[model samples]
Target: MIIVIDGLNRHRFGAVLDEMYRLRARVFGDRLGWDVDIRDGKEIDQFDHLDPAYVVGLDDEGHVVAAVRALQTTGPHMLADVFNAILDGEPPIRSATMWESTRFCVDTKRLGRGRDRHSVSYATCELMIGSLEFARRSGIRDIVTVIDPVMDRVLKRSDNAPYGYVGKTAPMGKVPALAALLDCTQERIGRVRDFAGIAHDVFLTEDAALDLFARGHTSVEIETAAHAASANNDTRPLSALERYFVEQMSAARTSDEVQAVIDLIDALPGTLTPEQKFALKQAPAALAREA
Candidate 1:
């Protein structure tokens, strides 16, 4: 089962530390040839100790098949902290609501298996949603992350166009890594589609097209405006938390009132089970119509 645990006590974290280390060693140490010392199969770094980070993935019997780590941009731990000189004037990431996602890894042995891949994908989406929820509560409206070029295309297809600026070309060895940003708002959430329209610049490059498929970017042809309309018009059903948020949004008569509703939703619990959390993240707009 794919589970997302927050406030992970050090013991539970220690249980999976080896799996994380081996994963990093396999992907970064050996595959990418990063200068990481794989001591006793554990990857440790200063940022891992300083940041209030969370780990999301599965513990199948005894092996960890997938994992991703997230960190807030509050102190010396921001991505800009390490890459400041490389970025153009620090990129203003401190002023934005952002989460730096790093060390994403999946077990290569689990690739051909059906359930394992699904679990990994689901856990990843839940982590992203949880990060957005955390940002909302903290008064951060934007999310920024440096992803592998392939992963960046996956995110673009999973949502509508990203909301912020893309920086000038930066090196990712031979291929370039893009700095993509998203607005984690209810309206923007509603705008998310499984595929970007062909008219968008994303579909113009052969490399981009290949990367999209390689990363398993699920394709849904629905346009963003049409998806939002469908979500707004559908009044079929909703969960209790969904009903509560929907009614609050319906009662909102002004911009401030709408924002208040958003704030309330953002401040709600961030540690929900993956399934319940996805429902919570998607429910407000779907249920608001019924109210």
Candidate 2:
């Protein structure tokens, strides 16, 4: 029962807003002792509202749990605005088919407490797949993010490395931090796996990152370089028809609405190639089908 909501509308966005803040506070404030304000048990920053992001996750009853804030390079965001220092004056951040991944998290309590083994980890992977698919459909190919070194190591091992400079070690309360870029390709997408047995503390390192990259994952550097050169320039954004379909899907209020939107997307011309169409149509159904 994973849900993905588009836009920043209050209702959907608000659903997990508090949860996100609480998680961040627990991780950064309480666990790491960051200076984040926890007045109402929420950790929020000024940059949260600048981009169009997605929130994905499951509810308490064995549901998927996830959320992401996506922003393009055209807007005021980390890559172009805040994190420029890390990029070392690289090409002036301008327009590109790039999306930043932000505020991603999974519910800790629901992680390993059920019959489903690695439920939380698998849900996290599913959320990434769904979000990557959505980004591809929306015309984005590069993803930028600041991840925990351990998670960065896992991504590198998974072959999802980015093509840019790794940022200087910053103090995330007590833990270290690094920034990276990732190339979102079908090949890389296929290699995404569950974060099982990842050593939570010892995850980020050049060796670990390379191990992941050697497996076919590109580093953030590669993603950034490709983006800088516009290597995949010919990639197409979603057609107007596809956009309409997604809008309809996002607005769907019932199971019937969901099926109707899926059907309409399936029928749209050029929305997906034949093979991709089969995968897209079957994925959601394989996991949870109704109606």
RMSD of each: 18.7, 19.0
Residues 184-290 of candidate 2: C-alpha lDDT, one tens digit per residue: 77666666633333212211232332233222222222232322333234444444543454344334444676677677656767745654444334323221212
Candidate 2 wrong stretches, greater than 4 Å:
8-13, 32-37, 59-64, 89-92, 113-118, 163-167, 193-291
Off by over 4 Å in 1: 1-8, 35-37, 59-62, 113-123, 133-140, 173-175, 186-291
- How does each model score on lDDT? 0.49, 0.53
Q: Per-residue lDDT of 1-291 in model 1, one digit per residue for the tens?
A: 223333544333443455566777776677655545677767666667764454434433335555566666666543576545336665546653566656766665554433222454443444455455445655767766665566666566556356654455465543455566777775554443222111111111322322232222111111222233343445434456655654554443345665566666566676333443343334233212111
Best lDDT among the predictions, by candidate number: 2
Residue 258 in candidate 2 has what lDDT?
61
TM-score of each: 0.53, 0.57
Q: Each model's number of backbone clashes? A: 0, 24
